[model samples]
Target: IRYSVVAGGFHEGEISCMDICIQRPIIATLSKEDSSIRVWNYDSGECELVKSYHSLQKEFQNTNQTYLQSVALHPSGFYMAVSFIDRVKVYHLMQNEIREYRSLDIKNCHSLKFSTGGQYLACID
Candidate 1:
């Protein structure tokens, strides 16, 4: 089955790519070229969360701004891993909030994925 969602938001730039949560089929995640990530419910076509680059960088003390190279949602729908210029970050989604879960110091991360069982996260630089 295919579902279409029109996320409601004002974007300074266009979206780069998108991914869906495997366990929660109704949830979708989108990454913007401007280094923002948004999570929404496809079933409702409403944006549930928005994380700007500035807000996300504040968590890691990243003085140098970076764009999101890729994003991947965990199978369980509770986690997301994203690749930036010099690091990979995992985020936890809970009760409409997004928070930094873990950080990996890796340069030029190009892609990310969660293991089928959601026990492991992998990134390719």
Candidate 2:
């Protein structure tokens, strides 16, 4: 198989987090050196920003170093998980609605992934 560039950016900073859907019509989720996740429809050249709930906090807003460290998309394509400095949040994806499903307290989380069955999630600092 051959390869082609879908989109470009993050040239100045390394990508801190990323995840992709498994099924056809791929959807990509990415986070850079900032506390925002971006969802991309590469085929359509559309991108939408997904902000972390933690970013809304007064403390987070004041800190320049605060950013998303990792991201994982559920194999079922119905959820996404992202690791902030000390917390991991899961988001439910729907046709007309998207909401945070839950959060887990994990300090200094830098990477994360969901199990193949999507029943469990793991992360590392």
- Score each candidate by Cα lDDT: 0.74, 0.67
lDDT of 2 by residue, 84-110 (tens): 777888988755446789988887888
TM-score of each: 0.77, 0.70
- Winning model by lDDT: 1
Cα lDDT of candidate 1 equals 0.74
What local lDDT does model 2 show for residue 48?
41
Give the Cα RMSD of candidate 2. 4.7
Can you list the residue pairs that collide in candidate 1? none
- Tell me the lDDT of model 1 at 15: 61
Clashes of each: 0, 0
